[model samples]
Target chain A: MSAAKKTALCAMLCAVSAVLSTLESALPLPVFFVPGCRLGLSNLAVITAIPLVGAAGSLSVVAVKSLLILVTRGVTAGIMSISGGLLSLAVMLLLFRLARFGFVGVSVASAAAHNTAQLAAAGLLMGDVRVFSFWWLYLLLSIAAGALTGVAAGVIIPPLGRALGAR
Target chain B: MKKLSKTPLFAAADIFIIALVLALAAVPFFISVKGAGAPLSASVKINGRDAGSYPLDNAGEFKLVGENGIEMTLVVDGDGVFVKDSSCRDKICERTGKITREGQSVICMPGRISIALEGETGGADAVVG
Candidate 1:
């Protein structure tokens, strides 16, 4: 694909991810294990962008998504979102390099890494390690959240790639 | 490039990751439960410094000032402690709900404050002699 086409596709992916992120926060999920934990539905677009737009494109999607959260949530939340979103995209790229793992594996691991990174960021910002120990349940919830996003990505990515004429 | 496959929602690598995460997730629960007893108090920390600790039965609501001049209202009751109000936008601390178990806590990341339930430190392995 041409550079312009890739840019357009990345922009579109970013828009979709931003919408997903907004939608997720608006939905009241049946979660009690941890505070502020969501199903990471926004990550579905990033996962789909992995094969269609590769690392750079996916990174933009994550960046835009975080930026949106920062504007909507607050400064601290924005920082956490960027840290978590970047780490998540990095993990997804690394998993894609394996070339054999499915979307579920990558999305699941990415979701877990995102939550871990955010908690770690919160701990560092607060200058405390206790946050990790206190919020261990967040990691446990990542599995189901990751699978949900992965399933959505799995259904959308193939068709999206074919339509976009991507590699 | 090979596209992400859908037939197998979970592959060998996914299973391995799930196992690893599950084991990691269980570690904290084990540590928290190992030395716990009936919680008797709640301790509040702001910006990594201990602000104060009160009896679990303190049964009153009080405000705390944390880093960045963040204000949080914490409620301490007979059964548990929780954030009644917070200045942070997300209100995650407020949503953490009441924590009753020893070693459990409610934290406000934006406010840089944490409220943890504290209990007596004793175990069956302790020897009277």
Candidate 2:
């Protein structure tokens, strides 16, 4: 309810999201598919923060989580991770502003944006535009995964928001 | 907010797309194996002296020798190339299995090592770059 309470709650959410992301990073995927390519469980915090604390708060949470990861993981992977986070946050904020499609829509958009950003980064890093040939496949995958995680976040966050009381 | 319900349409779409990807991934396996490209043999020279040669075999195995008499085996498969056996921590190179496509690479940061596949495209419908 109070501004102070909201700030504190945002901070806590960011911390939780960082921890979730770190854990997700440890899970192994196939060798061809890049690891840490998943829209982390911590993104739930970002989705929740969007509606509860507004765009600024949501962006803050994303920035904090990315910064924490960057510091811990070092620069090589951190650069791409941060880029993806920023892109996801931007997409979620845009969707939240444009349509009242609720959390599901925002989550899907964020997920799609996240994948797009990563693929874009990969293309640039590898010095081959064909890298984006895989974008369509990854985009589809991100939407599915993003929707699943977004829905879960939508259900869980309101209560947590209430318990934490308007932060 | 309305209670979220699972939509059959979404599920159907998911299955269709997944099947499509599986099909795409499998095409390479079924196609006839073209003769292996110019065996990736080259005397890896750092400055002038020989570092080693990556004798690319049709069976997809190569030998990597370092300046200090260290030797490693690199294996390439349908999936990608990886250091089958290496005396390096982080096993990053080992984990980066054979890369058959252009722009894909496996880097061993500690060993200052890199194994990459260049000028080759994925086994999909030939969409030339």
Q: For candidate 2, lDDT tens digit of each residue in A63-166?
A: 88878867886554566677788998987676556544556556666776776676566555544343443455556666567668867876786676567655
Model 2 docking tier (incorrect/acceptable/medium/high) = incorrect
- Per-residue lDDT for B8-106 in model 2, tens only? 113323344344444654554443243344234322332233354443343466677643343567775554456777775345556544556443455
Stretches of candidate 2 exceeding 4 Å from the true structure: A29-34, A130-133, A163-167, B1-74, B77-129
Model 1's number of clashes is 0
In terms of lDDT, the best-performing candidate is 1
The TM-score measured for candidate 1 stands at 0.90
Q: What is the lDDT of candidate 2?
A: 0.58
Q: Which stretches of candidate 1 lie over 4 Å from their true place?
A: A31-33, B1-8, B120-129
- Model 2 reaches what TM-score against the true structure? 0.63
Looking at candidate 2 chain B, the ten consecutive residues that score lowest on lDDT are: B1-10
List fnat, each candidate. Answer: 0.49, 0.00
C-alpha RMSD of each candidate structure in angstroms = 2.5, 7.5
Alpha carbon lDDT at B98, candidate 2: 54
